[model samples]
Target: MAYKKEHVKERFRPKPGKLLDQVREVMHYHHYAIRTEKTYIKWILDYIRFNGTRHPREMGKPEIERFLSHLAVNRKLAPSTQNQALHAIIFLYKYVLDMPLNDYIDATRSKKQKRLPRVLSQSEISEFFKHISGTKELMAKLLYGSGLRLMECIRLRVKDVDFENHQIIARDGKGGKDRATVLPKPIREDLRLHLKGVRKLFEQDLAEGRADVYMPHALAKKYSGAGKSWLWQWVFPAKNYSKDPRTKKIRRHHAHETGLQKAVANAAKKAGINKRVGPHVLRHSFATHMLEAGKDIRRVQELLGHADVRTTMIYTNVMITNFETLGSPLDNLDND
Candidate 1:
């Protein structure tokens, strides 16, 4: 029953023609977000197609520079969009192809836009919420109340909320950071009632043998069966199960972000607010209103998870000018 040594060697050798599969494996190993995995793959495929599908291993810096230039000059992409393409290619070479990029790529950079965020006033905020109801309304409330990004509100897990402390622990927020934020007292009872419904859905999922959600950073392995646990369930679960892109297993996910976006947009339109408003506008309103209410900018920085106070200071530009804070020159003259 002896086996051929060549056949044995063949079994251990890596299979050919699976570069993208290899990239996916590497990304999974690094615990990249599912959305990021999809986005990176898209950019990589676009790069390949733009260059007539030449294998990435055959291309180097000149080709990389040329493609990035095309994105800026030809496609007229934003700087962030071009940078995403660059990062995808860099990841492919560095991690998947085992080749590192040079210190400088020397490509034409894309256009940078420094537009300020759109914000809603307090009355407009009231009007905006009046037009929407149910889960989306709750999501919008949390976005404005907790100073949460749209996706941050979407991805909240059950265990991350602290009802007693009146705070929410936003897990894995933008830039891979986490922060604690205040949960509005007004929404507490509604949120608790909402969770009761969600818990019932979780129980139903368990009874029907479909109660599992995605976990980050190989946590699903270390804490096997934790995915189906009540604490790990999404605070706002999707209405349906879908195939996970990485594992190919059917798992329920957080509510799709687009649905919330559409709901908020329609709600804004129906509310007859003139200015362009979206989920992010609510976040902007949160920061502005907090500052207006005399909350310290540094404290707002921590709650909003801003890396620097400079970033938080953008909200100050939208604050109403308080001339009273600087007594009028006429008043000063009268005093003198």
Candidate 2:
């Protein structure tokens, strides 16, 4: 029985490599998203560096607690950021190193901040659009018009947009869930014109034998040539080809999110809107305006692809309130 147990442990041990490489191998074996893999690897590296380059196997729960506490107390990271680091370290120890942490990690937890989502007024939305043009304008419109998250908009494929049904399918959205969202009728023609250009790029890539886009999960193997097909092409392809970070194969990816992020920031400054703005602010505006127009909260929740109605309910708190109809108590007292 002792010999059998040792044999089993040897058979399941991780392949020999540097620790980060081993982490990547284990993460890939579990089918983690590339973004998630990158995030986890970064945090794990930070954890190792914080502990004076000590091997993680040498340090355990107390070291983790101190690192997390430092992030909360010294670095002043948000609660979410601290949680991310904790999760990353946990993944490293538990999965890659086969060292599950103890239940109690007494880290100084970061306080969760209760902040409202920033939304743009309908008039402000119009003003913001006036300053943005070209592809960024269309992308911004999708954020407001379709209630898409920034990554969702960036990652859209050619077949995801359904003009006939007047809906956009957000495939593998947040939480790896798929949902359909509205496609504003007003932007249909603009979207079609934009696709005509994307189609040309697709054809060019095909002629050069470089048309493949990244496929999710086992689909690349299941379908074989689907990655090279028109249906899988990015709706918003990058201006130039680049090497895939993981595969090292040169291909055109979807446009970088930073371009739209910078555009939104610059447009907000140019339009003179005071509040901090980003791509997500447009999504918040979409939810708020939808509710303001008497749209059902349930319907808005579906459109936003929120897992819970409570998550959508936060918009109600920030929705426009009519002041004229509900005047102050001083007005009822006949002030003046």
Candidate 3:
């Protein structure tokens, strides 16, 4: 008695599902990063909504190509946006349905345009700082003086700060590469006071059996007891505690970046900044101002942790106003 062909086919097919988490789990199985998981899930959702609730398994390569192409051509999206969507769909087919790519795709890929980033001047930065007050002032100082990204500033751990060495070790920074930056001398006293407050909080949490913070990926795997230790505590602890997604353990993490963002936004408005200002403006100010102070470009590049000096040179163009006093552009202007 042989089984029916339809029954065998149904059993072999991938288990159909509607819940988003099910699809997300398939992407996670490949050890893809959190950003990739988020992007892939979002694109899959967009693909579904774009076609008015069409099932992904039912759709073939043509439909996927059409969606990606539509994003590039119809939506007039930047190349990065289109490529992000492309990655999401690629993950969908490659991991979710166990389908290989590289067949029957007529997607139009957007080309990335090379554009220079905007930078701020030292005086402009000072003016910007004068308008900012409270915690935002410190956050700005860390961003500009340390050349830290906003997330990096917030994510800084207690142990990462080396007051004796006058350096701050940035762990799991952009690209998961660790590097050290100069800790501003001006803020050391204030920073010490701030950390004292953090230490007090740590003591309170320790008393309540809630001292542990987020740990390194392998650390959590190696020692189950490590999550509750003082060394694992976040230097800039979050107001609330959260359970680690990987370890299912509660720990205090860093302050939320959103709070800092909103604070900066409000401060910028009060400061009367005509141009748009953001947490990143401090970073732009850092690189540009360092170059203005006769610091060697290569040294600035090293301090910025740029992979290529050419990327760092873009600030030279942003600093055009600085050269206005270079023996005067009007020295020859009168004769001309």
Candidate maximizing lDDT: 2
Give the number of the best model, judged by TM-score.
Answer: 2
TM-scores, all candidates, are 0.89, 0.93, 0.82
lDDT for 169 in candidate 2 is: 99
Cα lDDT for residue 246, model 3? 46
Give the per-residue lDDT digits (tens) of candidate 1, residues 1-336.
111111111112223568788777777766778788889999999888888999998988888889999999999999888888888888787767767675578899887888887988889899898999999999999999999999999999999999999999999997789899998999999999999999999999999888988888879889999999999999999999999877898978889999999999999999998887788999999999999999999999999999999999999899878678967777757554
Query: How does each model score on lDDT?
Result: 0.87, 0.90, 0.73
Taking the tens digit of each residue's C-alpha lDDT, what string does model 2 give over 126-225? 9999899999999999999999999999999999999999999999897779999999988999999999999999999999999999888778889999
As for candidate 1, its clashing pairs are none
- When 1 and 3 are scored with lDDT, the better candidate is 1
CA-RMSD of model 3: 7.5
Q: What is the lDDT, from 0 to 100, of the residue 138 in candidate 1?
A: 95
Better of 1 and 2 by TM-score: 2
Candidate 2, residue 301: lDDT = 96
Give every collision pair in model 3: 158-235
Q: Model 1, poorest ten-residue lDDT window? A: 1-10
